[model samples]
Target: MFFTEMWERFSFYGLRPLLTLFMVAAVTQGGWGWDRSEVGAIVGIYASCVYLASLPGGWIADKLLGLRRAVLYGGALISLGHLTIGISGLVEHKLPFFLGLIFIVLGTGLLKPNISAMVGDLYPEGGARQDAGFSIFYMGINIGALIGQFITGFLGEKIGWHWGFSAAGIAMFLGLIQFWLMSPKTLANIGSEPSRHPDPAIQAKQQAQVKLFTGIGLALLALVVILVATGVLTINAPIVGTYLAYALIAIAFAYFAYLFIFGGLSTDEKKRVVVIAVLFIFAAIFWSAFEQTPTALNLFAYDFTDRMVGGFEIPATWFQIINSAFIILLAPVIAGFWTFLGRRNVNLSSPVKFAIGLGFAALSFLIMIFAANVVIGGGGIRVSPMWLITFYFFITLGELFISPVGLSSMTTLSPKRFVGQIMGIWFIASALGNLIGGLVAGNVDPEKLELMPKLFTTTTLFLGGAAVLLVILAVPIARMMKERKGADQPIDPTQEVPDLPKE
Candidate 1:
C-alpha cells in the first residue's frame, strides 16, 4: 500500500510542479499561451474541483462500493486525467486540455478519500500502531512529493513540459497497476466492512444504500462529462460555464449533505459536520497560501528570484521541491514532538493543532519579509536562495501539524457511515483554498519585483492571525467534543473513527 501510494503521489505532485509553467508557456514552448488571469482561473478552478470531488469520492467509498472499489475507480480516473494531459501536450487541442483537467479533478476526487481510508483501515482503533502507520504513510507521501518536484521541475523547465507531464501520467499508470496487482487484505487494512452481523433485512438495506451511492458517483462523473461534452465546450466557453459547473457540483454537495446531516445523522454527527466545515474553511486558508508553490510561487521563483548559484541558473521549477523536501526532513521531528507532548498528556487537539499551523504559517511570512528586505539587484532584486528554503521549513511544519492530523481527526470524529463524506468536505476546503490561492496569486505584480514579499506577507499575516483565533476557539471546540465523547470511543475498532463534536 505504501509503495503504491508513493508512486501515485509521485505522479500527482510531478505534474503539479509543472502545471503553472505549462499554462504560461507558449505554443512553441509546449504551453497553452494563457494570460496570467486565464492561467489563474484554469489552475484555480482545476485544483479546486479536484479537492471538491472528495466529498463525492468519500460517499462512493463509505456508502457505496466500500473502500476497495472506490480506490480502484479513483485511481483509474487519475490515470486517465494524466493521459489527457499527455494528449493535450501532443495535439494542443484546447477542448482536450479542459477535458483532461476535468478527468484529473474527478479522478482525484475518487482516489484520495478511499486510499487514505484504507490506510487507517489497516489498524484497529486507538492503538499506537495506527499512529505509527500514519506517520510512515505520510513520510512516503512526502518522499514521493520530493522526487516528483525534482523530476518534474527539472524536466519541465530544462527538457520539456510535456515530458514532465507524460512522466506523471506514466507514474500514475504504474501505481494503478501495482494497486490492482497487490490486494493486501490484512497488510495495512484501512478498515473492515461497515457492518456484517446484520439480519438479512438489514443487510439488504445496507446493500441498497451502497448501490445508491455507487450509482451517484457514476452519475456525477457522467453529469460532468456531459456538461463538458468533449464535442462541444472547448476552452473558449464563457467563464460562466465553468462557474455553472462548479455551482451544480456545490448544489449536489449540499443536497447529499442535507440527507446525511439531517435525517441520516445523529446530533453528534451533525456537530462533527459543522466542525469539519469550519476546519475545511481554515484548511482552505492554509492551502491558499501553501499551494501557491505550483502557480503563484512557481512564477515567483522564475520571474522574481535570482536563480544564480556560483553563476549557475537553477530552473524555476526546482524551487517547487523545497516544501516536499522540507516535509521529508521534518516529519519525524514533528512526529516525535507530538509523541513527547502526548506522553505528557498535553492536549494536541485538532483545533489547537490547526491554530499552531496558522501561527507557524504567519511566522513563515515574517521570514519571507526579511528575505525580501535583503534581496539584491535593482529591478526586482534577488535574495539568497536560502530564504525560500528557510520559509519552506516553517511552512512544512505548519503542514505536518494540520494536514495529516486534520485528516486523522476527520476520520476519527466522524460516524462510520459518514467518514468518506466528511473527508470529501475536507477536500472541498482544499478546493476552495486552491481557488482562493489563485485569486490571491492573481494580484501578483507583473511589473514590480519587490512587491512579491509584500503580497505573500499580506496573506501569511492573515493565516497567522486566523491560527491565533482558531487556537483561542480550539479550547471551546475541544471542550465541547470532550463532553459529548467522554466514554464513547469507537465501537468498531476497524472503523478508525473519532469524536462527537461542537467544534
Candidate 2:
C-alpha cells in the first residue's frame, strides 16, 4: 500500500509542477502559451475535481466495487491518463491533454479515499499506533514526490514536457503491477468485499439504485463533454471557478446536514461529526495556502527567484521537491513526538494541532510577504531561492501537524460503516483548498509585479486570523471530541435513543 501510494503521488506531483508552466509556455517551447489567469483557473478546477471525485469514489467502494477493486481500476485509469498526456505532447493537440486530466481526476477520486480507508483497516484498534503508521505511510508519499519532482522536473524543463509526463505514467504502471501481484497475499481479507446489508432484497434494491444513478450521471457528463468538444459550449474558466468556490461550500454544508438529520449515528458520533465539520473549514483554509506551491509559487520560482547555482541554472520545477524533502526528514521526528506525548497522556488534541498547523502556514506566507517586497524594492530583480525554501519548510511543518494527524482522527472518530465516506469528506477539505488556491494563483501576474506583496499580505492575514480563531475554539472543540466510555464498541441498531449533551 505504501509503495502504491508513493508511485501514485509520484505521478501526481511530477505532472503538477508542469501544468501551469506548460500552458503558459510559448508554442515554440512546446507549450500552448495560454494566459496566466486561464491556466490558473483550469489548473485549480482540475486539482479540485481530482479530490472532489473522492466522495463518489468512496461511495462506489462501499456499495459496488469494494475498496480493492476500486483501487485497481483507479490505478489503471491513472496510467492511461498519464500516457494520454504524453501522447498529447507528441501530437501537439489540446483535446488529448484535457482528456488526460479528466482521466486522472476520475482515477484519483476512486483510489485516494479508499486506499486511506484500507490503511485504517489495518489497525482496527486505532490510537497513537495508527498515527505513527500513517506518518510512515506519509513518508512513502514524500519519497515518491521528491524523486518524481527531481526527475520529472528535469525531464520536462530540459528534455520535453511530455517526456516528464510519460515518466510519471510509467511509474504508475509499475506501481499497479506490483500491487496486483502482492495485494492478494499481503492484504488477505482486508477490503476484499463491499460493505452491504444482510437483507438480500434491500441489497438488490440498493444495487439497482446505484446503477440507475451512475448511468444518468455518466450520460450527463458525456453530453457536456460532447458539447464542449464540438464548440457548442464556451467556458469562461475563471468565472466558473469563482462560482465553484461557492458551490463547494454549499455541497459540504448539505452533506453534513444529511448526515446529522438522516444518517443513523449515535449522539457521540454526531458530536465527532460536528468536530470534523469545524476542522473541515480550517483544513480548507490551510490547504488553500499550502497548495499554491505548484501554481503561484511555481511561477515565482520561474520568474522572480534566482536559480543559478555555480552558473548552472536550476529547473524551476526542482523547487517543488523541497516540501517533500522536508517531509521525509521530519515525519519521523513528528511521529515520535506524538507517540512520546501519547505515552505520557499529554498529546495535543487534533484541534490544538490544527491551530498550530494554521499558525505555521501563516508564518510561511509571512516570509513570502518579505520576499515579494524584496522583488518590489529590487525593481523586479530575482531574489534568492532561500525565500521559497524557508516558506516550504514552515509549510511542511504545518502539514505534519494537520495531514497525518487528521487522517488518524478521521478513521478513529467516524462510525465504522462510514469510514470510507468520512475519509472522502476529509479529502473534500483539500478539494476546497485547491480550488481557492488556484484562483489565488490567477492573480499572480508578472506584468503587475506590485500585486505580489499585496497578494502575499492578504494570504498572511487570512491565515493568521484563522489560526487565532482555531486556537480560541480548540479547547471547546477538543471537549466535544472526547469519547464516551463505550464509544469504541460497535453501535447496536436496536439500542434505544439516549439523551446527549448539547453542542
Candidate 3:
C-alpha cells in the first residue's frame, strides 16, 4: 500500500509541475502556448476534479466494489491516462490530452480515499499508533513526490513535456505490478468485501439504489461530454469553474445536513461530525493557499525568480521538490513528537493543530509578499531562489500539522460504515482549495507584475484570519471531541452494520 501510494503520487506531482508550464510554453518549445488565465482555469478545474471524484469513488467502494478492487482498477485507469497523455505529445490534436486527464481524475477518485481507509483499517485500535502510521504513509507520498518532481521536471524542461508525462505513467505501472503481486498476501481479508447492511433485503435495496444513481450520473456526464465535443455547447472554463465551486459548497452543506438530520448517529458522533465540518472550512482555506505551488508560485519561479547557479539554470519545476524533500526529512521528527505528546497526555487537539498549520501557511505567504515586492522594486531583476525555498519550508511545516493528522482524525472520528465517505469528504476540502487556488492563480499575470504583492498579501491575510478564528474556537471544539461515548474503547470489527437512512 505504501509503495502503491508513492508511485501514484509520483505520477501526480510529476505531471503537476509540467501542466501550466507545458500550456504556457511557446509552440516551438513543444507547448500549447495558452495564456496564463486559460491555463489556470484548466489546471484548477482538473486538479479540483481529481479530488472531487473521491466522493463517488468512496461511494463505489462502500456500496459496490470493495476498497481493494477499487485501488486495483483505479491504478489501471491512471496508468492508461498517463499513456494517453504521453501519446498526445506525438499527435497534434487535443482530444487525447483531455481524455487522459479525465481518466486520471476518475482513477485518483477511486484509489485515493479507499487506500487511506484501508491504511486506517490496518490499525483498528486507532490512537497515536494510527497517527504514526499515517505519518509514515505520508512519507511515502513525499518520497514519490520528491523524486517525481526531480525526474519529470528535468525530462519535461530539458527533454520534452511528453517524456516527463510518460515517465509518470511508467512509475504507476511499476507500482501496480508490485501491488498485484503482494496485496493478497499482505492484505489478507482486509477491504475484501463491499460494506453492506446485515439484512439481506436492505443490502439488496441499497445496491439497487446505487446502480440507479450511477446510471443517471453517467448519462448526464456523457451528455455533457458529447455536447462539448460537438462544439454545440461552448463553455467558458473559468465561469464553469466558478459555478462548480458554488455547487460543491452546496453539495457539502446538503450532505452534512443529511448526516445530522437523517443519519443514524449518536450524539457524540454528531459532535465529531460538527468538528469535522468546522475543520473542513479551515482546511479548504489552508489548501487554497498551499495549492498555489503548481500555479501562481510555479509561474513566479519561472518568471521572477533567479534560477541561475554556476552557469546552470534550474528548472522551475525543480523548486517543487523542496516541499517533498522537507517532508521526507521532517516527517519522522514530527511523528515522534506527536507520539511523545501522546505518551505524556499533552496532545494538542486537531483544531488547535489546524490553527497552528494555518499560521505557518500565512507566514509562508508573508515571505512571498516580500519576494514579490523585490520584483516590483528590482525592475526586471530576478529574486533569489531562497525566497521560494523558504516559502516551501514554512508551508511544509503547515502541511505536517494538518494533512496526516487530519487523515488520522477522520478515520478515528467517523462511524465505521461511513469511513470511506468521511475520508472522501476530507479530500473534498482539498478539492475546494485547489479550485480557489487555480482561480487565484489566474490573477497572477506577469504582464501586470505589480499585482503579485497584492495577491500574496490577500492570501496572507485570509490564512492569518482563519488561523485566529480556529484558535478562538479550538477549546470548545476539543471539548466536543472529548464527549465521544466510550472514546477510549477499541472499535469492534464485527459490530452489526446499521441500515442507512432512506432519503
**Model 2: pairs clashing at backbone N, Cα or C within 3 Å:** none
RMSD list, candidates in order? 4.7, 4.9, 4.7
Total backbone collisions for each predicted model: 13, 0, 0
Order the candidates by lDDT, highest first — what do you get? 3, 2, 1
Q: After superposition, which runs of candidate 3 have C-alpha atoms over 4 Å from their true positions?
A: 339-344, 485-503
Model 3 gets an lDDT of 0.84
Model 3 Cα lDDT, one tens digit per residue, 100-129: 999899899999999999988998876556
How displaced is residue 127 in candidate 3, in Å? 2.0
TM-score of each: 0.85, 0.95, 0.95
Q: Which structure among the candidates has the greatest lDDT?
A: 3
Residue 402 alpha-carbon offset, candidate 3, angstroms = 0.7
Instruction: Tell me the lDDT of model 3 at 448.
Output: 82
Angstrom error of the Cα, residue 71, model 3: value is 0.5
Per-residue accuracy of model 2 over 1-503 as CA lDDT, tens digit each: 99999899899889888888988899899888898888888999999999888988898899888999999999999998998888887787788888899889989988999988997788776654564566567777888899999989999988988888899999999889988999999999999899999999998888788788878876887888888889999899899999998988888899899998899888878887887788788888888988888989999999999999897899999998999888777766765676577578675666778788889999999999999988888888999999999999999888877776677667776788888888888888888888877787766666888888888888899888998998899777655444343646443211111111000
